[model samples]
Target: MIERFRAGVLAAALTLLLTGCSAVMVPVSPADSSGLGRETVRVGIAYDSAGRGDKSFNDAAAAGIDRAKQELLIEASEAKTQAETDEARAEALRGLAAGGSNPVIAVGFLYATAVGTVAEEFPGTLFAIIDDDSVTADNVVSLLFSEEQGSYLVGVAAALATRKDRVAFVGGVDVALIHKFEAGYVAGVHSVDPGIRVDVRYLTRPPDFGGFSAPAKGKAAAARLIAGGADVVYAAAGGSGSGVFQAVAAGRKAWAIGVDSDQYATADEAVRSRILTSMLKRVDNGVFQEIQAFVKGDRAGGKKRYDLKVDGVGYATSNQQLGPYQSGMEKARYRILSGAVRVPVS
Candidate 1:
């Protein structure tokens, strides 16, 4: 079963000026006078399925850890998730923790069980998991994001940008987390026009992490939706999203929506124009901030959330083609933030 609750209130906006065809993140060093005795914190990252090259969730988390490495001067070790299993995940985390990785970070919800098991054994090691809050151990911290909120915003963009009143969603996996993205998207499209047609599909089921890695599957899924009259497609399918981008680019009048990072800046130039916008889930910020908090000795175990009101999630504006939908996007964002509209988390 899933749950729903309002996130804490905060105000901020993400503005990136894309000058050289890509967004370069400036390293954020720890502030002066924290008074921590150690000069550097050793971090061990147990990455989610498909590893750092997936160019989606895992990659976003990697960017943050990289920033920490450069700015905080931390010694970090990274390990990718192996076969989807409690034992495999736990062994990976235990290897990191046993190797003196103070803050062992697990990068996905799949590691929830592994993290709980390992954090219990290594009580002194601080553990962090992204997208999973089931663990309540005193030594663990769960960094969660309002993915639905950002998805809703981009859904609005899709609704406003579609030429054929038809949009589609391609999810990496058929799970609760991906369902959150699906549910909010349906609502957003309906909010724009209740009669608009929306198509939804998932690449793979749980225990088979192929959905996040198989770009060929994502491409085929998007192609099917496009053939079925979907002119706009949103992909929350990690590296598999690359396939969706490819499908949309090859189509006649179709557009693609990216997830996690800004595909407009990161995607290939040939397909870049086909990507109207992306639901910017700031995984990098969440990871970096949590690490900073832990460094300051504030590792209280609980859900540390990111949401729309705080700029934790948003839509990419790097593409000039999305300018036409800016006013409506801003209005929808205001509604969501002002409680006039509430995004469902499935």
Candidate 2:
């Protein structure tokens, strides 16, 4: 039952979530980008405190691990988060190591401290940390993204789709990571419409929001904006964004833009058709490539940053049904990428 619940969260399904499910992850494959060398590797992934239910960042990371499982012949496991602790991360890594996994990968910057100390303690085990990298061992691989580029594109999408010149942005926590996304989106909005106004708000002021699992707050923040006459909202907040969709659904006239994976499918039937689009960070690609690289003796060393120019991030306008203004979004997306237009990255 616990496994079922975790799967439901990772699937980002608002409904059909079976009660009492535990977290379970099966990593993906390396078969897509050419043939895999003959080796069966096992990998472990850790989630932020929000767990997978928040359905944005953690889910995106899981997707990458899923890709590794499908393409690479490997065993995959997951560590459910209880808090931000090196002990929890180290324990997860230890489990992966015990299974003979050569290189265990940790998702999110929260895993940095865990990866840093654990990597040193287990010098034989290779490690990969996504989003933020450490100054530790040569055995670790860091995966970062060019979020500014994607944010710029999505910012344009928000500006184009916004009914009022007033748009808004909501983030999980007001940390540097969220700030990066905020900065990029703000730049994008300003580039298209200088006078465009965006009310920036974070679920928590700083350092924390333990219930990163709360979608209610997302709805509340979005509702305030909707009431304030803002017609478009971009939320980089995780599980809380489930509420953003609810707020968008209520507003009817407004639309919610999603992040990480395409969020169109993540919404309810009534509002899903209304989602402007999603800004994608191909984290799954990063995780999958890391596995392939390790297997083929080509793992990237030091800090690796993925950007729009490198195809690491982009916008997904394609969906079950393209939204009301798909073409405009596409044009803006290309313009930003090709340098024909510049979106602010903050």
Candidate 3:
């Protein structure tokens, strides 16, 4: 089941400008009123450009915070990046940290530089950054994932499901992080059938993060791939995956794959049938566990890697269309976990 929850939005009057962006405080669940004396810790999340409604990467992170709000004695607030500039990201982090939010969480790799710069200024504050490990600090915890390992499993599914013996990968941005998805997918496709052709396209290049949020661009990219004979399409784009699904559905015979969250569960009923499977990147689990550690006074900071062996990343089999490929995907999963298959990150 895909757990969906929306954070109560504060009124515009409550919006506070920390630097140039607004940090809206989300109304969190009440603390435990029992005699256990539960102290509420304030948690802040700095979201990427797409924010909460992206239903992909940002939503996965929000799901984690929602889980924390329900299960832990905590208050939460979130600030989103308005501009692609590093200064804007730093300001979001600054605003959250300045407002007394401990263990401020940066939701995407885009915040790596901002987190490192802001962490130095707020030495007492604990910051956790997702999808990034470049920030090395006593107060920073890097939450990294084995994206290629999970992508490889989905690639295997795409390879097995393709009718034209041609598959395609749609990425939101042409960055090093997204390259891992493309590499694993290509590797997985070739593993199943060395003769099958795999095509890759990115919506936008670096510094222009709009690619993650542009559905039109995603649709156009997928449409082109489908026109070129791709029978199965995998999109690692953020919100843009929705467009890819639409294009795949219109293609009628093509299958679409989702990333980060189970797009099969979240997709529209019209397009849900076309989704073969999704690459599940458990960002929610990572965020919830980080919060749990913070609540227990275990704020030790370092790099924590979530991989196939730990069930941190895998393929979602929510759709019935994925049934035929389950055994093959499982075999691929085992191979990855057993170190027999070394997925490429480039």
- Per-candidate TM equals 0.88, 0.82, 0.88
Q: List per-candidate RMSD values in Å.
A: 12.1, 11.9, 10.8
Per-residue accuracy of model 2 over 1-50 as CA lDDT, tens digit each: 99998997887554324321321222235455432223356677777666
lDDT of 3 by residue, 68-183 (tens): 88787477999999888899999999999999898899999989999999999999889999999899999999999999999999999988999899999999999999999999
What lDDT does the true structure give each of the candidates?
A: 0.86, 0.75, 0.89
The list of candidate 2 runs beyond 4 A from truth reads 1-39, 319-328, 339-344
* Deviation from native of the Cα of residue 178 in model 1, angstroms: 0.7
Q: Which predicted model would earn the best lDDT?
A: 3
TM-score of 2: 0.82
> Candidate 1: worst 10 consecutive residues by lDDT?
5-14
* Clash count per candidate: 0, 25, 0
CA error at residue 86 for candidate 1, angstroms = 2.1
Poorly placed runs, candidate 1 (over 4 Å): 1-36
Of 1 and 2, the candidate ahead on TM-score is: 1
| Displacement of the residue 28 alpha carbon in candidate 1, Å | 22
